[model samples]
Structure formats: C-alpha cells, structure tokens
Target: MTALSDAEFVVRTVADTACANEEYFGQLDAVVGDGDFGYSLARGFEHVLAQWDDFDRTDAGVFLQKVAQAISQRVGGTSGPIWGTAFLRAGGKLKGHETIAPADVVVALRAAVEGIQARGQAQLGEKTLLDSLVPAIDTFEAETAAGASTDDALAAMAVTARTTADATKELQAMRGRASYTGERSIGSVDAGATAVAVMLEKLAGAWPQR
Candidate 1:
C-alpha cells in the first residue's frame, strides 16, 4: 500500500481499538486514577472515526493533523492535550511528504515522543506511557537499522511494549493523576502505558491482514 493508505489503516485501527477497549482501559485507570483515561481516549478516537471521511486526505501528515484537531477538541481532561500533541508532532514531522519511508515512521514517532514529553512534562521511567513507548520505539528503530523486515521490527516493538508496560508496576508514579497516590500507585500499572502496549500489539496483529 501507499504510505497514505498505510497511515489511514493505522489511524483507523487505532481509533477502532481504543473505542472497543474503553471499559478495559477505564478499569486499568481506576486502579490509581479517576478512571477517565479510557473515556477520554475513546471519545477522542470516536470523533476521528465519526468524521473519518471528512478529514483532508492530501497526505498522511495532513490527515493526522486533522485527526489531532479532533482529538484535542473532543477528548476530555489532560489526555486531550497530551495525546493530541503526540499526533500533532508526528504530523509536523511528516509534513510535505507525499510518500513516507520506513525511516520516516521512526522520525515521526521520535517527534511524537518529544511532543508528549514536552506537553506532559514527563519523561521515561515516570510510570507514564513513555516508560513503555520510548523503549518500544528504540527497539523498532534498532531492529530496522539491523536489517530486519518491517514486520519483524514491529513484532519486536509489540513485545517490548507489553513487557515494558507491565514493568511499570515496578515504578512509582511521578506523573499524571497516579502521582497523587504516592506509594500506593507502585503496584498497579499505568493505564496509559498499558493502552499503548495494547494498541501496538493490536497493530502488530492486524498488520499481516492489511
């Protein structure tokens, strides 16, 4: 598929998966938060799906920028700005590219990670999604650099995402609502981290079908 089509497929899958797992995500968040993460994510992604066809499709970057607007405007709470920033930064990284290469994905993601860090004022090992996401991105980039196929790189990413997400249990919350819980948040996983892992796993699983 063309890069635009691939981007579309990934965005669609991400929205659909988030919407589908709302309750599960909420439960994860409820462990240490007010359980709003899932609702925020699902609502934002639902807007993306609801207006999917109306989005500008000039290129992957433009499409993602449009979706970022939807997510920023529609999603409630802190999640809106954080996730919207991620999408917006990625879009900015890919701006003006008619067709993207594998390396482009890494560049865009690196931008997204930076955006999330800036917007959320968080970093790796903060018991946030970054804890899992950063490592997963690193693994993907390393695998691709080592001459692995996209599929293999993505599969490794999924594995890293899952393990690192679960590993958040060993971390103390230093960001987000979970931070308010102090030591109480140590045992539970971060909902955002798990959600990232689940999304990557779902993407890896559906990639072959695509």
Candidate 2:
C-alpha cells in the first residue's frame, strides 16, 4: 500500500481503538487523576476521524501534521501535546517518502519516542507512556536487527508493550498527577501507559505486511 493509505489505516485504527476504550481509560484515570484522559483522547481522535477527508493523504508528513494539529487543538489535557508531538516528530522523519517500509517504521517509532522524552522530560519505569513505548521499540529494533519480518517484529513489539504496560501496575507513579497517589498508585496500571499499549497492539494488528 501507498504510505498515505497506510497512514489512513493507522489513524483510523487508533481512533477506533481509543474511542472504543474511552470509558475504560477514564476509569483508570479516576484511580489517580481527574478521570478525563479517555474522554480527551477519544474526543481528539474523533475529531481526527471527522476531518479525515481534509488531510493530505498523498503526503504522509502532511497527513500526520494535520493529525497532530487536530489532536493538539481539540484534545484537552497534557496528553494531547505529548501525543501530538510524537506524531509530528515521526511524520517529520518521513518528509520525502511516498511509501514507508519496515525500517521507516522503526525510525518513526524511535523519533516519536525521542520526541516524547524531550517534550515530557520523562523516561521508562516512571510509570509513564514510555514504559510501554520504550520496551516496544527495543523489542522491535532487536527483532528487526536479527532479520525478523515486519510482521514478526511488530508482534514482538506488541508483546513487549503489553508486558511493560502491565508491569506499570507494580510501579509507583513518578510522573503526572498519578504521582500524587504515592504508594496508592502501586496497584493500578497507568492510564497513559495503557493507551500506549493499546496503540501499539492496534498498530501491530492493522499494519499491512507488504
């Protein structure tokens, strides 16, 4: 598939998955936050889906820029900017590409993770989204470097994302409002990390193997 089609499928899949899991995310947030993370993410993606026709699908970079804009503008919360910046950074790396390959995917994920780290000043084991994303990227990179297929690499990444996200349940929140919970946060899975896992899992399922 062309990069544009692939981008469309990815955006649509994430939007659908986020919207479907909105309430659950909110519940997780309620355990440690204002309980609106799911709502904001769902609304942001819903806006993206609504404006799908306006995106310049022919250009992957343009498509993602528009998506980042929509999310940053419409989504109400810190998550909006963090996620938007991730997409923006990843998109920027594909500026001249008409089609993206598995290597491009790895580069994009790496860029996105760097963007998040820069924007949030956070890292793994802090009970943030990075907990899911970092491990996923590591697994994907290792698998791909070992000559795995795109499908196999993505499957490994998804597994790492799931495992790491679940492991957040054992960590005391060290970032965001969840951190305010102190020891109380130890037993709950991080809402943001859960979103990361969901996004990765959905991407693994939706991405086409050329």
Candidate 3:
C-alpha cells in the first residue's frame, strides 16, 4: 500500500478503537486525572474520519498535516498537541514517499516517538505515553532488523505497546494532572499510554495482511 493509504488506515483504526473504549478511558481518567481524555480523543478522531474522503487525493505528508491541524483545533487538552505532534512528525518523515517500505515504517515510528517525547518532555518510566510508544518503536525497529516484513514488525510493535501500557500500572506519574496524585497514581494504568496501545492494536489489526 501507499504511504497515504497506510496513514489513512492508522487514523481510522485509532478513531474506531478510541470510540469503542471511550467510557472505559473516561472512568479511568476520572479517578486520578482529568476526565476529558475519552471525549477529547473521540472528538479528535471524529474530525479525522470526517476528512477521509480527502485523504486518498492528497500526498501522504499533506494528508497527515491536515489531520494534525484538524486534531489540534478540535481536540482539547494535552492529547491534541501530543497526538498532533506525533502525526506531524510522522508526516514530515514520510514526505515525498509514495509507497512505505518496512524501513520507512521504522523511520516513521521513530519520528513519532521523538515527537511525542519532545512535545510532552516526558521519558520512559515516567508513566506517560512514552512508556508504550518508546518500547513499541524499539520492538518495531528490532523486528525490522531481524528481516521481518512491515506487517510482522507492526504486529510485534502492537504487542509491545499493549504490554508496556499494562505495565504502567506499577509506575508513578511524573507529568500531567496525574503527577499531582503522587503515590496514588501507582497501580493505575496511564490513560494516554493505554490509548497509544489501543491505537497500535487497531493499526495492526487493520494491516492488509494477517
């Protein structure tokens, strides 16, 4: 598939997954963090789906640029900027690419991780989205290096993302509103990390190959 198609699939899958787990995230966030994560993600991705008709007509980079802009404008709170930056960085890395190779997927994922880190200024073990994204990227890179296809690499990455997100329950929050909970934040999965894992799973599921 073309890079544009891959991005479109990723966006649609993320939106769908977020919609499916909206209430779960809301309840999770209501306990230790702001309760807007689910609503914000739903709204942001709703806007993304609304623009799907335009995706195939545009270049991959331009399509993602538009998605980033739309999400930043429509989605409220930290998710807007963090998710927007992730797409924008991935789009930047995909510039001028028609079809995305396995290596291209690796580069795009690395750019996404870097963008999230730069935007949130949070690192691994901080109980943020990085906990999921960083390990997922690492797994994708490792799989690619091991001669895996794009589909296989993404599948491995999805598993790593989910595992890392679940492991966040043992971590203390170091950023965002969750940080205020101090030790109370421990034993609760980071909503953002869970959301990232959800997205990764959705993307892997949507992959054309099994």
Candidate 4:
C-alpha cells in the first residue's frame, strides 16, 4: 500500500478502537485517576478522522504531523501530549519516505516510545503506557530481526502489548494522579496502557488486510 493509504488505515483503526473501548478506559481512570481519559482520547481521534481527507493529500510525515497537531489541540490531559508526541516523533522518523518498509515500522515504534518517554518523563514499570508500548516495540524489533514478515511482527507486538498492559495491574503506580493512591493503584490496569494496547491490536489486525 502507499504511505498515505497506510496512514489513513491507521487513523481509521485508531479512532474505531478508541470509540469501542471508551467506556472501559473511563472506568479504569475513575479508579485511581481523573476519569476523562476515555473522552479525551475519543475526542482526539474523532478530530483525526475528521481531517482524514486533508491528511490523505499529504505525505506520511506531514500527515502524521497534522494528526499530532489535531490531537494536541482537541484532546485534554496527558493523553494529548503523550499521543501527540508519539505521532510527531513517528512522523519525524518517516520524513522523506515515499513508502514505508517493515523496518521503517520498527523505527517509527522506537521513535514513538522515545517521544512518549520524553514527554511524560515516565519510565518502564511506572504503570503508564510505556509499560505496554515499550514491550510491544521490543517484540516488534525482535520478531523483525528473526526475519518475520511485517504482519507477523506486528501480530507478535500486539500480543505482547496486551499481555504487558494486563500485567500492569500488578504494579504500583509511580506517576500521574494514580501515584497519589499508593497501594490502591494496584489491581487496576493503567488506562493509558490499556488504550495503547487496544490501538496496537487494531493496527496489527488491519496490517494483514492492508
């Protein structure tokens, strides 16, 4: 597929995934943090989808850049900064590429993880999205290195992302408002991580057909 088509697929998948899990994320947030995460994510992706026509007219890098700006403007809370930074960094990694290769996907994942880390200043095991995304990226890279196809690599990454996200329930919160809850944060998955898992799963599912 063309870069523009791939990006469009990603955007649509993200929006749909977010909408499907909005209530679950909201419930997760209500436990140990502010309960607006679901709404914020939904709003951000909605804005992204609304601008799909405009993004389709641009290159992959510019398309992602526009998406970042749109999400940053439309979404509230840390979700805006975290997701915006992910897209912006991924865009930078894809700059000047007419078509994205499987290796390019790995590079973009690394850039996204770095961007989120830089923006949130949160480390792995912090009960944040990094807990999921970091593992997912690692799995993607490892699978790719083993000569797996893009579809297989992404599938492995999605499974790891979901597993890691679920595992976060056993960890204590070390950042965000959830940290304030101390031991109470345990037994509940991080909302951000859950959302990331959902997004990655959707991306992997869409990759094969695309």
Candidate 5:
C-alpha cells in the first residue's frame, strides 16, 4: 500500500530534481521563452516542500490538492496553471482514498493528462510538456494493464518520459514562445517537456513499490 507519507517523498524527490536542473532548464528556455520556468517551478515546489509538514496528508487526495494549491499560488506563467490543474484534477479522482493502489494511480494519471490537455489546449507532437507526459502515462497504463507490477509500470513511465523529452529536440515548436522561433526550436529541447520528464523520472525512483 502506498501511503500519503510515500507521496510526500515522491514530491520531495521531484522538488530536488527541479532544483538541481533549474539552471539547465533555464538555459533550454533562454532560446525561445522568458527563461523563468525553471526558477518558477523550483521556487513553487520548494514552497510546497517547506510547508509539507503542516499539510493534512492523511489521504492522497488532500495531499495532492495541497500540492496543486501551492503550485498555483507560488508559480507564475502558463506552466503554473497547467500543472496546478493537472494535480487538482488528478487529486479529485483520488478523493476518499486513504492509500493509493496501482490502479488508483492509473486513474489519477489519466485525469492529469486530460486536465493538462484541457487547460493547455495542447496535444502531443506540439513540443510542449504533453509531448513527454502523454507518452509516459500511456506506457504506464499499458504496462499495468498487461499485468506489470507498480514498479515495472513506473519504471516504464520514467524511461518513456526521458526518451520522449529528448526526442522533443527534433520537433518543431507549435506552441508557446518556442513556436515563434520556427526551425530554430528544432535543435533545442522543450524546457517544459524536460522538466516533466525529470519529475516523472524522480517520482518513479521514489515510488514505494521501487
């Protein structure tokens, strides 16, 4: 059983990843964006981690809702609202659950993907975070449906996310500031996609099942 405490660890792990990669992400964004995504997300998650001890984390829903709230309140730019909505929608699906099972995680991930799509009005192959996140969730759901353990499913998610993020370098930007760069964006990775990949990879590593 994955407890709320375990969820905290995953968030903390992602926060650590965000902080460690902030400069790298900033560099990625510098070519086409305001170059503040890394700093915004790092500070937002830092705030969430700092207040984690005071959150009502008896269940996954409450815990995730608080995390969503922190991101929305502390982070700026399109990434904040999009990420906040993803967490908020996903957490809503897990309401009333004291512990999240592997199946519950599947439901949450689906909701998160849907929320991100709805909020961003973006789709795969658009060189956004969805480029990485959608494939990871699809791989995870497929693996789990095929009788993979939580560990294996999560591992697949991490691997797929990383690969997808890297592949973004070959994709032309179709959204956000990067879109304005046209072919210039093709050789550079999407900063948002890279951040999502890092977070997913770290979360998989911190999973209780691992």
Candidate 6:
C-alpha cells in the first residue's frame, strides 16, 4: 500500500518545483508562447500549498480531487484546467483506496495521462508536457514491473523526462499557443515538458524517504 504521506510528499514536491522554477518555465514558453506558463503554474500551485491542510483526507482520490479544485479555481488560462484534470483523474483512479499499490500507480498514471489528453486536446509529439510525461511514465511502469526500488524507478523517470523534454526541440509545436508560432517553435524546448523533467528530478532526490 502506498502511504498517504507519500502521496502528499509528491504533490508538495511538484508544487514547490513549479513555484521555484517560475522564471525558467516562463522563459521556455516565451520561445513560442505568451510567456505566462510559469507564472500561471506557480500561482496555481501556491494556492494548493496554501490550502494544503484543508484538503479532504478521505482517500488518495479525494485528496487529489481537493488539489484539483484548488488549481482549477486559482490558476488562469488553459493551464488550470489541464493540470487540474490530471490530478483529478489520477485521484479518481485511486478513489476509495486508502492506500495505493504498484498496479494502482500504473492505472492512476494512465488515467492522468488520458485526462490530460482529453483536457488539453493533445497527443504525443505535440511539443507539450505529454511529450515528456508519457515517456517518463512508460519508464516508470517498466522499472516497477522489473521490481526496481522506488528510487530506481524515480531515477529512470527523471532521466526519461529530461531526455524526452529535450527531444521536444526536434518536434514542431502541433498544439497549444505554441502551434501559432509555426515553424519558429521547432528550435526550443517545450516549457511544460521541461517542467515535467524538473518535477521528476525533484522526486528522484526525495523519494523513499517520503
């Protein structure tokens, strides 16, 4: 069973990372977007942190649902709905479970991915977060099935995220505001994808303990 504490730690890590790298994410987005990506994410997650203790602890699903509420209500533009949907779907997948298992982890992640796709109307190679996120989750599932320790799985995920995020430089922006930049978006790394890499790297350093 995955401890509630562990889930809390991961969510908190994601929020902190988003807040800390606000400028960096904005810079990435500035290459092809309006440059508000970082600011939006940071503000949304800050609200999540502010409401941390008030979140329902009925189960992992309910807890994440509360998180989704906070983000959707606080964040602006497209980011709020997309990011909130991810947590909400993940939480839904784990609903009723006071704890999560490795298999549950897989399903929850898959659900989150699906939610992102539906909400963002994005697919792979779109030069979005999914570019990194999908590959990283694939690595995560493989490592878990191989009986890797949590640290090992997280390590692989970090590497995959960083690698895939960088690889987005080779793909044209096919979605989001970046798509409006046309061929000009091809040369820059995706802001959302890089953010995913950063978040995974943060998790790699702190997993096992949480």
| Tens digits of per-residue lDDT for model 1, 53-76 | 999988889889998999999999
Q: What C-alpha lDDT do the candidate models reach, one value each?
A: 0.92, 0.86, 0.84, 0.88, 0.84, 0.92
lDDT of 5 by residue, 90-198 (tens): 8898878877777787788789889988988899999999899888888988998899988879889989999999999999998887888889889888999988888
- In model 6, what is the error at residue 28, expressed in angstroms? 0.7
Task: Report the C-alpha lDDT of model 3 over 77-139, residue by residue, as the tens digit.
Answer: 888999899888888888888887777877877888888889889888999889998899889
Higher-lDDT candidate of 3 and 6: 6
Pick the TM-score winner. Answer: 1
In model 1, the Cα lDDT at residue 175 comes to: 89
**Candidate 4 weakest lDDT stretch, 10 residues:** 49-58
lDDT of 3 at 104: 82
Compose the digit string of candidate 6's lDDT tens values, residues 1-210: 354666788899999999999999999999889999999999999999999999998877888889999999999999999999999999988778866767788899899999999998999988999999999999999999999977898899999999999999999999888999899998899999999999999989888666
Global CA lDDT of candidate 4, please?
A: 0.88
- TM-scores of the models, in the given order? 0.98, 0.94, 0.93, 0.95, 0.92, 0.97
Q: What's the residue-level lDDT of 164 in candidate 4?
A: 95
Q: What is the C-alpha RMSD of each candidate to the true structure, in Å?
A: 0.8, 1.6, 1.6, 1.3, 1.7, 1.1
Residues 64-104 of candidate 4: C-alpha lDDT, one tens digit per residue: 88889989999988889999999999988887788988788
Report the C-alpha displacement of residue 81, candidate 2, in angstroms. 0.7
Off by over 4 Å in 4: none
Name model 1 segments beyond 4 Å from true.
none
* lDDT of residue 71 for candidate 4: 92
